[model samples]
Target: MLTQLSLPKLQIPFLCHGQFMVRVLVVSQAVAVVLAFAPGVYGDVWARLGFISVFVHWISIITTLCLCAARHKINQLKPISIISVVLCIFLTLTLIVSAVAFSLFSTLFNSINHEMSDFLAKNLMVAFIVALVAVQFLIVHAEKSEQLNAQTHAELNALQARIQPHFLFNTLNTVAELTHIDADAAEKSLLALSALFRAALDVGKLVPLQTELELAKQYLSLEQWRLGRRMNVNWQIPDALPAIQIPALTIQPLLENAIRYGIENSAEVGKLNIFSIESRNALTIVITNPYYQSIKSSGGNGIALDNIRQRLMLQYGSSASLTFGNSEGLYRVKLVIPKS
Candidate 1:
């Protein structure tokens, strides 16, 4: 009962703005058609449409301005709600004023000096109705947009929290063993592990290639210490490619997951390769690890990979892609980052 009562209400400002603008455009178009048929009907229908476009453009501009101003850091909902009501009132007044002016200009021209107050009043009423409908549409749109944004933010936070458990749980177990066997090696391992966590925590949705490389190296160092003679690592990062940016932790987590699953699960020795190349205005990172389906029955947990792919889509739209495949018993993951 309390959860239902206390649920935060969400509103989407973009959708509201969109619906309002679209209605305004439709109304303006109708008005232009009428005006073109009236006295002194300028060029062609296309010219009248272009002229009406300007007013529609202004409506969008003003609505955006209103939204930008709507944002506030107020804690209490009442004050913000009051402000939103006030903004709606202001928009209504603006519409009324615009309607009055248009009606007066369209009907009471000096060339005719005709008494058309009744016609002008009717047009004003129509305009007010149009504006009110637009505002209602705007409110509904805003609510949806706000809900979507909240969901996206929550998902991102969940993904970040999920990563810590998978890597840290395994690392801590390795550290526990290292501490008892070799004190000096364990100390170095702890430091490298700290760097790894720091890197994960510091990263964002997108990061520079140089930063990723540094973090990748730190991760490899920590894992090497943990695995000792059991793990072999190779990295091929060209100096020219260092400046290029990639999705944050895009390459490292996959590498870590590969090592953790590939070598830790296998009794036989395992090797990992990290390679990057810039070709055809695209950056590709390939991570390869030995795979034995008999020993490791399942595929990846998929959360981290899915997170990376989603982040790529959110940040780079359709320009970037990630692919996974197996060839001759070697598991490979590839990331393609487009320059264009």
Candidate 2:
């Protein structure tokens, strides 16, 4: 069954994120600075700034802690419900912090005179306004993020779809040709094709490196059967392949391109080599095949290579790369995947 991609739900900004926390602190300080410089007549500007900073920081820290504690449950709520709950939290925290700070100031600094009711009301009003603005910003950010994700998934699905029909036609043609010579071999090819199709259709964005290697092997097996004496493959994989997640169908498409442009086009037997090198920070896979400059194979427009490159970019950003070029009479394709 084909599963359609769903847009990600709107989520409250996690206070646990360092960036969110830093922004909160910075904004709080900015508010304190603005309050200190406001038109109201104040005794000492620095003292007023300090007092406001302490009060706002207290409210901000407590609110952040409370939200962080309940973030998991809050995230599961509907968007409107999340906003209501978060606003309620902010208002409640503001009231409590204001009451406590007012009592402390009254007790410790008798010179300062402010009514508890007025202070509490002021804090609650400010908190409500700030919370409303922040919530609106978060909602907008989440919506934009969700839309970007949906667009990426759509593009990925389209790119993935492009590969499938090409793969199916080529495999089916090979099987059809094989059926004339050997019925049993054609049946085995069909079974392999079924596994390949299942993996192609069912796989998510990422799969284990070993799984991709297996898929590549299955693809090569089909090609080997079709090409007979002309197809040759060499594997230099590690005994203990690094435990890493790779984009699905990462290797098979490259191998298909290799066979189509290199082995199938060549008159003599072509050597295809697949090897991997693992480093502390990254894993690299290299595929090489005999390159004949004279043989102009049809459909060498590099659709498969481009699809894989886009998928790699979407999956790993700049941390992964796919590069291919003719080097030393062999067409070499190098794929680098970050281990992190």
* Candidate that would win on lDDT: 2
| Model 2 Cα lDDT, one tens digit per residue, 1-340 | 2112222355754465556678889999988888777886457777777888998988887889888789768977876677789899989988988888887776554324678898788778878889989877877777775665566556657766766687678789999998899999899889889878787775445789998888888888888887889988999998698888887878887887788778877888899999998888789999999887742354442666766777676555567899988867899999999774
lDDT of 2 at 6: 28
| lDDT score, candidate 2, position 85 | 91
Per-residue lDDT tens digits of candidate 1, residues 1-340? 2232333442322222345556656666666566546776444555545544454455445654555355332212443353355456445544654555456454433332334555446444654565556546645644654564455456656766866677777678777888889888778778877877666665554578787887788777777877778888887877666356565677777887688667776676788888887887678989888876732455343665766776675545456788876788788888887653
Q: Against the true structure, what is each candidate's TM-score?
A: 0.53, 0.57
Provide the global lDDT of candidate 1 against the true structure. Answer: 0.62
| TM-score attained by model 1 | 0.53
Every model: Cα RMSD to truth: 9.2, 7.5
Candidate 1: list runs displaced more than 4 Å: 1-163, 176-184, 294-300
> Once superposed on the true structure, which residue ranges of model 2 sit more than 4 Å away at CA?
1-166, 180-184, 292-301
Largest TM-score belongs to which candidate?
Answer: 2
Q: After superposition, how far is residue 295 of candidate 2 from its true place, in Å?
A: 10
Q: lDDT value for candidate 2?
A: 0.78
lDDT of residue 81 for candidate 2: 74
